[model samples]
Target: MATTALGEYLSARRAQVTPELIGLPTHGVRRVPGLRREEVAMAAGVSVDYYIRLEQGRERNPSAQVLDALSQVLRLDDDAHLHLFRLAGLLPVPVRPAAPEQVDPQLLRLLEMWPDNPAIVLGRAFDILAGNAPAYALFDGFQQGPNLMAKIFLDPDARSFYPDWDEVARYTVAGFRLQQGRSPDDPRIRQVIEELSQASPDFVALWDKHEARGTRMTSKRFHHPEVGELTLQINAFDVRSAPGQELVVYHAEPDTPSATALARLRATATVESPQADQDPGQPASSRSSWSGSPR
Candidate 1:
């Protein structure tokens, strides 16, 4: 029997919801990892057989109300709830080819203006489309390639570069899952996922969790070889001019040790000009590329 995306997603999510999480008493040794089909059906006001059919790909279409109830029982967040709807075909999934990512000239200028803040523009597949000097300096040695996912997971020094390696890995995988949901058919996204899955066991483990969420404004600790330990808050903004592009800026609070370290790093970092033959429109200090494509 062929398994549908909806079925696979439902099964994965169901396995994550514990019986105790929904006030169901755990009396004996349970064979399954999470709530049983019958328990889920009962909680969601559906028949056991119907729920089973949903998980087995026999049931194709379910009402919005039913999906909502199942989402509640599964304890899904906003992103996960939306992802479930998309998998169930209740929400439209935009199908488009991955186009070459180009950072807008105005955005590039904006990045050049912020000498103190480390800012980078990320493509749909988390490719480093563009980065100012400070941003490049911050990422420095760990940026083995253009893709942030590859740098975080495939790079040998990534674990040491990020003190919170485990947390960073989980967050990166979850963010990638969110991007995958948005562009399910994009070859670029698929290539990145396939490559990481083959290369990193840790990535495979985190990807299996099926957590779909975008990157939020959060503080991240980085152990820069030159600057020592630094904690910076990351802020990500969607590029309204171009879809599937995000501008991520890292900043340290004023009057903090991190701020002092960042200032020192910025002061020591020299901006690199674009090559003579490089695009004139491209920012002088910005490093831009779509080099994440599979070799």
Candidate 2:
């Protein structure tokens, strides 16, 4: 990626947004495309001079708090926000060599056994290494990466798939932050960050918040095209055989509507064999089995 000055980026983003976009009124024909320096300074709660110093590169060392404020005032997205912090030299994810993670052969069979539950093994980068029939059906038509982060941020269908998209996205970023912290040197983690940061504006904005909590087991809703709507509970477990892999299982109460919906799904969905790379709905995106999720 090309490097740009932090101040330069701040200035450029400032010029691209309009005052009206942020609830500020415009009185006459405006010469500039975006907010004025004074307006940005006021919104960010920094002195005009201080803000100017930042723009001129006179002040390079901005605290996290200050960057957050400026990022808001600039209307930057999650990816852009994180990029700003990196430009400011604030996000320090050091690179170190590490061993590649391997998913156990036995776990694949276990995932297949769970006909009622949606189960998958996620790699450190949240890649869906392997999933059961129900899990594949649950995510039908949406496989940006077959990786949670890519699916959430890169796929247009994600918003429809997730009812509480924003909330879930926040938790997703928080979970990624925690995992990245644990494996700063993992190349897969770095790859995920780089790919999403470049592709998704939302990911950029949410990432640098340093959200440190991994997603806990929680009940969430999904709008399944075949089944209408279903609420499923998430269960996350560390894969004992794989150092940075996680196993996520999803299920509903036996008698609940969700359970019934899953039953219907199982009937129509093909139980894909590992050899079924030619499965009609299985695209190249679903080819990799790196494990990750918001579970």
Candidate 3:
């Protein structure tokens, strides 16, 4: 019904926040998704009409105290909190476009050095800007392009790859939303959203929900086709030298089955392993810079 960005976010977030999450009871005949408008209004210490207006795009520029209260009620993480401020035009600093999408030569070399670890560098749009052999093996074959958002939503195998598919999808969309804060008119963001919306209903629903998720270190479980179930902690880092680029590394606990699987994957990897360092077109294998040859 022609929603403003703020309104769409508030509405979707409200839907995802369960009554029990914020200590509300399961009342009978509940029809609406997530916490009710009245419940949110009461919890945020605002009038019901005001809350509705905020969700409907009739109200914007909420005071810091009000925004903080709403964030608490919705259980938003730190990244989501900043995104909310940015959406309301509350952030003090002027927003700038993400730095030019470039992966330093040294950084690519560093990724190759981590033979045992599955590491990848992600561009702003979640494209696999570069990755090591293990990281490439982890993703393996996916019909959807290298962009993670596309693979998660469009690929047929993602459901089995990620045990908790719904949760992962939500977080991915939220991360994209957080990126949106940095560049409002980024064509890449718009392109991904439009294509995914038409291709996957799940993406459409999650995107409408407006969960602003900042990239953070977290644990994730994957059912690897080759290695069975593996629990790995995702270490996400912002490249200080190149803003908007993330160096993500995967770690499995020592002495665990997952660790053994990782070792096996490393052992199998050879000097002739597939190159995951760049997009499909330009393979790094034939290039002159071949010092770290996937060993």
Candidate 4:
């Protein structure tokens, strides 16, 4: 209906480019920074007039082919390429969405049965879709206002949560960036990204690098306030039937202190009940402590 918003994207990207990047000759008198529309058109195998029209918002609809050409010539990263499509009003290529990812009833039953193992099911955006009692007790703090990303990045004692805090932060940001690339328009995701960017310089630095990686499997350390540090092998798996949902299971080495700590954590729940169902019997802070237990 209306002309696209390509002008701003084009302008911002243009200013960031240097003459050397596009193989252009520069004289001492050349004042404007970055590649001109004509130079970009030449590099992209398009005419100057067409490029000008696109930049001026006169060309509202560009084919995927054309967008691809511009993307390559400008050396736009994945995020920048997607942003260009959004600004150009070209229907972005469809991507997977982390919609209602329901856990299998059988899995729920299994979790209920195992009051001893700490476990949780997470969605693509780090939403805690479901978790078990042992998991609830071990990670009690992260559960109440549970946002996995925020917990890792915003919490004051996050370093204490993970002994390898730097590595953990990098992985967390990279995972968040991957989801952001998939659904840039989600306000909640955007808000989390912005909030984290403002809150953590390390997070901001990692984001600026434009890294994107999914957390499939890793080892993590948890410094439990009660039981000291526990190292566990972390396993992450996707529910093929329910796209975008992942089951992250934590296992302590057999007969280790971590395992003993987990036993103590699990002992909190002699009988597994739905968190809401168990709340009546437990104090609010005690319930919170159960949910905030470390993985």
Highest-TM-score candidate: 1
Model 3: per-residue Cα lDDT over 222-280, one tens digit each: 88777788888888889888666788899899999989887776665554434444454
- List candidate 2 stretches off by more than 4 Å: 1-100, 275-295
> lDDT (0-100) at residue 66 of candidate 4?
85
Per-residue lDDT for 60-147 in model 4, tens only? 7878788888888778877567656665667553355434445666555655665556777765567566777777766766632556
Instruction: Point out the worst 10-residue segment of candidate 3 by lDDT.
Output: 286-295
Residues 84-201, candidate 2: write the lDDT tens digits: 6766778875443455544566676677778878887787778777777777677767556557888889888788889899988988887777667656667778889999999989
List where candidate 4 sits over 4 angstroms from the true fold: 1-106, 273-295
lDDT of each: 0.80, 0.74, 0.76, 0.67
- Score candidate 2 by lDDT: 0.74
Candidate 1, residues 114-214: lDDT per residue as tens digits? 88888888878887777777886777764457888898888888888789988888887788887888778988889898999999898888888888878
Higher-scoring candidate on TM-score, 1 or 2: 1
- The 10-residue segment with the lowest total lDDT in model 1: 286-295
Against the hidden reference, what TM-scores do the models get? 0.92, 0.62, 0.80, 0.61
Ranking by TM-score: 1, 3, 2, 4
Better of 1 and 2 by lDDT: 1
What's the ranking of the predictions by lDDT, best on top?
1, 3, 2, 4
